[model samples]
Target: MKILLTAINSKYIHSNLAVRYLKAFTKDLDCECTIKEFSINDRIEKIFEKIIEEKPNVVAFSCYIWNIEYVVKLSNLIKILDEKIEILYGGPEVSYDGEKFLSQNPGEYLIVEEGEETFRDFIEWKLGIGNLKINNIKGLYYKNEKEISFDGERKPMDLNKTVFPYEKDDELHNKIVYYESSRGCPFKCKYCLSSTTHGVRFMDVSRVKKELQFFIDKGVKLIKFVDRTFNCNHRFSMDIWKFLIDAKTDATFHFEISADILTDEEINLLNTAPKGRIQLEVGVQTTNNEILKNIDRNIKFEDIKEKVLRLEKNRNIKQHLDLIGGLPGETFDMFKKSFNDVYSIAPEEVQLGFLKLLKGSSMRFETEKWGMVYSPYAPYEILSTDSISYDEILKLKRTEEVVDKYYNSQKFGNILKYFMPKFESPFDFFFKLGTYFKNKGYLDRNISSADYYRIFMDFTEEILNENTEILSEIIKYDYLKFNKKKWLPTFLNRVVEKDIHKKIRTELKKENIEDVHVERFDIDILKYEICGEIVKDTKYVIFDENNEDNIKYFE
Candidate 1:
């Protein structure tokens, strides 16, 4: 039998580890199994054509919220075109409500949670072609002419025995590959599907090292651990970290860690890691006490702040912080506080996302209790709650784009630093800036890189009276540091004595300084950089352009 295990991924750079695991587990079976992956961005008709070209007897799709709608439509078309082709569905989207989904979709069977064992057993016994036997194949809902029935749930497997899923390392180059050293999670954050399961299971440290070595050898650019909380077990996490630190491969390893619980040993070990070796994504969903309780996410804001700050001091590992906008108890005002709290940490990246009331999660069942309304479809993102209005959420949605372009993009770091203190709080500054962007229709269309500076300047003139030129100076310094462009933007081009560059170039050469690219500003950029206080003086900023750390100031 020819079986095709398909994956509709969210992006071209993302590889679906689930489909790979399915293929790996059933490797020894009699069936000729092939794995086919496509992006959700692909046209539905095109994907259908590709799937039909495979000419498989059985087609199984690894479903998820991002691509379930497309999968269901494709399944219907496949069944309509050729009834002889058998279809199977599995993954988080269908595992929770197999009965309702089975009644609606065209799939002949549904493989519930932890499908590696269940799918193998189904193939061994019988597929839809032969006998429709719904015997003791654990974690499956089989459909017959009479009705659809589900077998019992499957038990979780030992992490040590799970085979390495990625047989094709050549496909992972320059892509964001996913790896899992563990399964299940310790925390019961109600919003997450992980809360449905209990206990954490980890793979053996030695085995994990060997698998990582495989990726390093293959030149995989990134490997993001899918473990719910990578740092839950200090010993296991530390062993993995130590191996990576000692091996010192060029590939970057990323982990989603619970920062508040980080031990001093973990912090010290991570500190010693070579730059670009490790990146951490810390979820600080919110700092609001009421909202945290409502979601059953137990974390102290102070402890998170302390640990993140300690890690930031080392400057080796890059941290990306997350904040959710529309949690149950987080009103617009309350979310502002949460935003400011995370902003105080000064992470390298800030990801502002809305709460997703996913299926199989405890929070999804309690939506009525909280007066929450979400889209009646896959990826049920919260629209409004009793505490927050839909209009307020819309504003927050617009604000997210502004943050991505300005703050998260890291292009306006110095510009934000010079102007953020002028407002009440970080949230207020961003809120007002987003409002300006919305009013001017700048958000409606794509703004060029230079136009972004001009838009911000116009917004500043509307709000503040003076200090526009100083803002331009800050932007000029930021832009020069960004790229190797010799010409400045029209608005940013400043007047200076014609011989200034020659004199500065001669001075740098005389002092044995390698960088000759320099610019003079009327204000004391060096003193203002140290303390926020602006000191007036004729200052020359020697720009290395290539290295930010090499930037120096001359009086």
Candidate 2:
């Protein structure tokens, strides 16, 4: 029998492990299985065309918020094309609503929990044996006309029974590396799906070492751990960390961790981790005690600070901190405090995210109590309600972009740090910039980075020109460009000669008369957004006679 299993990922870097598990189980079981992968932006009809072309005997889909709608629509179309093909659905999305979903749709099967052994049995029964009974398969939710039935529960599979991420396929070896050191999460955060995965289960240390050796031998460049809280079990986490350190693998491993649970021993172990080998992403959600309590996130503010400082002080690890905007009782001012506290640590990246209320999470069950209003769509991303207005959420969304470009991208933090003391805090400064960007109609606008940089510089000029004292704090610079050299920040301090012609001549080592050229500006063409008028001295595109295409324009 031929089986096709796939997951629609939000991005190619986030491919699913479900397909890998299925491939491992079916390899030696005398079954032919293939996987078709696509990103979220890929068209559904195109995938259906491919499926029709393949004409597989059985089609199984891995469902999640990012790809459920597309999968469901395609599955229905496949049924219409050929009613005989067996359809199966599994993943976190269908794990909760499998019964309802299967009952509503006539000819679909739902596999709950881990699907390796059960799916293997299903394939063997269908392909080899005739008229075989299948009611005994564990963790399967089968639906009749009006009722849904479930088989006996299945125990979690031992990680030792599985293959490493890159062991199954050659394409997956060097192109991508995604593995999990542990399963389940200890904390019961309301908005997360990890809580539903139950208690933590760590893969054997020796097995993980073997996998790391394979990855190193293959020269994989990137490895991402899907573990919910990598630092939860101190011994398990530390043992892996020490092994990776001793192994001295060349690949970079990224781990999501709880900052407050970090121990002194773990800190020492992390210190031994080679520079650029590990990157840590700490989810700090919110600093407000009331909001944290409402969401059942057990973290103390002081401990968060202390732990973050310890991690940040180590130059070996790159730190990424995150904050969610639309949580219960988290006011704008309260969020500002959260931002300020996190900004004080100065992480390499600071991500401002909006809350997502997944279907199976505790937050979805208590949305009414929290006054949460979310989009009635497959993803169900939260929009603001009574506690947080839609307008405030919109502002937060823009704030997230500015944070991405300026803070997270590490482009403007050096300059923005100077304004931290002048404004109330870093959050206040970025919030005001977000409002400015929105007011200028650039929030959702599709503008190039070069154009946006010019526009931002124009705004900064106006703000600084209003108060020259700000100049004492922040550096004023312009990008220098040429055929041999590209645009690079040239500090104002570098140009002691005030005259433009003299400065150009001195910098380029050319005569003033030869370096200078007379240029004309169509006075009516310089559109300035802040002043709402045209400037007679300059035009939209300033070009040099030597290089006609070399020009920059701003709002």
Candidate 3:
């Protein structure tokens, strides 16, 4: 019999680690097995054609919230094309409500919780190995003659027994490879599905080190750890960090960590690592203590703040901080305070997200009790609550857009740092900027990078009444840093005599500056400030070819 394990990923850059794991576990089963992956962006007809071309007897789909609806429709289409094709579905979206999913969809099997052992048993039974009975397989739900039956819960697999999913497949080379040093989460934050599972099981440190070396040897660009809290065990995490430092590959490892749980030793290790070697995603959902308590989140906001501030001091490690807009008992004002608090830390990126009431999460059950109303779709994002109305949420959504475009993009860092202090709070600055964009219809229209620069200039001149020349110079510097070409915005293009460049280069030669390109501008050399210190603009911006760190201006 032929078997196919497939997944519809959210993006092309993502590879389905689940399907790979299933195929790896059932590799020795006396059946021909293959793995196929497609993105949701792919046309359904094309996916249908590809699957039909495979002509497998058993087709197992690894489902998730993002791709469940598509999988259901595709399964129905496949059944129509060939009723003999056995259909199976499993993942967090269908694992909780297996019976309902089977009743509504065309799938014949649902593997719950840990699927490695259960899938192996089911495949063996289908291939008629050793008179194996499907009913005895734990963590499996199957439909037989229109009757849905389930086995008991399956025990979690020992990580040591599981083989590494990557098997020298050339397709995985350029994708964002996801690695798991550990399974399950230690903390039970109510909104997360990981909270439902108890205890954390780690793979053997030697196994993890081998896997890290494999990816590094492959020259993979990024390897994101799927561990819920990567730093939950400091020893395990630090060992991996040390291994990466020793390996010295160009690959960057990304981790989701709890800031409050980080030790000083771990901080020092991260601080000394090579720049861009590691990136951290710290979720500071909300700063409201009452909401944090209601959600059973054990984070101390003050401790998190202190730890994050220390992490920010490490120029090598890039940190991305997160804040959720909607949560229990959080009003708009309270959320603004939360936003302002997280914004003060100055992470490399600030991800403004809304609360998603996911399936099987404790927070989903408490929606009614907390007076929360959310969308009843796959993602189940919150629409409103008793404290925060829908209109307030909409306003926050606009503020989120501004934060993503301006603050998180890192393109406007200098100007934002300069202008944000003028407002009552950072939230006030972003909220007003969001409002300005909405009023000018820029929010609804398509905008280019150059247009964004022009819009920022207009905002500074008309709304904030700040010095446009200084703002333009800051933006020009930012543009040069990000963009490769020497294109300037129309407003910033000023005619300068050739003698000005000659004079600046002559002055720079005395300072031992060589191999530099000089451009003259219209701004006053002596009056402007760069990075909070008065510096001569000289109308001459010097770019040294060898040194990116040395961007000099001469009067």
The global C-alpha lDDT for each of the candidates, from Candidate 1 onward, is 0.86, 0.73, 0.84
Report the lDDT tens digits of candidate 2 across residue range 36-134. Answer: 887778788888888878778888889888788888898889989899887888888888777788987645578887788878767777676566456
The digit string of per-residue lDDT tens for model 3 on 1-555 reads 887888899999998888878888888878888888999999999988999999999889998988987898899999998999989888888888888888778878999887889989988898788978999989999998899998789989898888689876656677999989899999999999999999999999998998888888788999999999999999999998888866778889999999999999999888888888999999899998888898898777999999888877857888998888789989999999989888878788988889999888999889888799999997788999999999999889889998899888887766676676679999998898888988999889899888877777888888978778667776666666565534667866545568877877788899888687666645542234344543544566677666655665665
TM-score of model 3 vs. true structure: 0.93
Q: List where candidate 3 sits over 4 angstroms from the true fold.
A: 465-467, 494-517, 521-530, 533-536, 544-550
Off by over 4 Å in 2: 128-132, 145-147, 173-176, 462-555
lDDT of 2 at 398: 78
TM-score of each: 0.92, 0.82, 0.93
- Pairs in clash, predicted candidate 3: 525-537, 525-538
Clashes of 1: 0
Q: Listing every candidate in turn, what is its Cα RMSD in Å to the true structure after a full C-alpha superposition?
A: 2.7, 8.3, 2.7
Predicted structure with the largest lDDT when compared to the true one: 1
Which 10 consecutive positions of candidate 2 have the poorest summed lDDT?
A: 476-485
Model 2 clash pairs are none
Give me the candidate number with maximum TM-score.
Answer: 3
